[model samples]
Target: MNLVSVQDLIEAGRQVSLTGSALAEQAKKGTPKQREYLYGLLVAGVEGLEGFRLFFRPFPRGSRA
Candidate 1:
């Protein structure tokens, strides 16, 4: 499993105007739409990080650079 830092989640929350534990709470108890929105934000944020780019890449066999 890929582990996401709390900092990244907080940043994603900031992008949506959420602050502090608000995002983490919503992630745990929010409606499906809210969870999905958070998921998207987290994924985008993680994918944007240089260290995580490789984990998100989908390369065919022998095609990875």
Candidate 2:
């Protein structure tokens, strides 16, 4: 998938819970390519956070959302 779609998927992941649960352990999520693509999504998310902080903006900032 492209970075844009990957970024969207990353954001969607934030809405779901997988911590401290059996599913979290059992879930074998993402393919090798997808896993690699996660780095880009992470970078995008960080950049979005930086933009929000620097501009003192609200959530879901910019074209990232």
Candidate 3:
């Protein structure tokens, strides 16, 4: 079993947050092809968030109980 440190998790969360921000920026004026690319990224981000959830204890507070 691989162990992840708190710092690693924080970095991953930051990266995902950045991805979401970029997605929003692109969505505002992106072409169809660009939007499709953003959709793929959004799906990947969701999967990443799910993976983070598994590592967390007590469900991480604010997120859906």
Candidate lDDT (C-alpha), each? 0.63, 0.50, 0.55
Best by TM-score: 3
Tens-digit per-residue lDDT, 1-65, candidate 2: 44334444444445343233332232236554664565455566667777777887555646563
Query: Distance from true position, residue 51, model 3, in Å?
Result: 1.1
Off by over 4 Å in 2: 1-28, 57-65
My TM-score estimates for the predictions, one after another, are 0.38, 0.39, 0.43
Query: Sorted on TM-score, highest at the top, how do the candidates line up?
Result: 3, 2, 1
Collision pairs in model 3? none
The residue-by-residue lDDT of candidate 3 on 1-65, one tens digit each, is 23433333334445566554544554556665655555556557868788888777476567895
Residue 54 lDDT in model 1?
A: 70
| lDDT, candidate 1, 1-65, per-residue tens | 34444555677667545685977765566655656666677667655674566777678898756
Error of 1 at 58 (Å): 24
Question: Which 10-residue window of candidate 2 scores lowest in summed lDDT?
Answer: 18-27
Predicted model with the maximum lDDT: 1
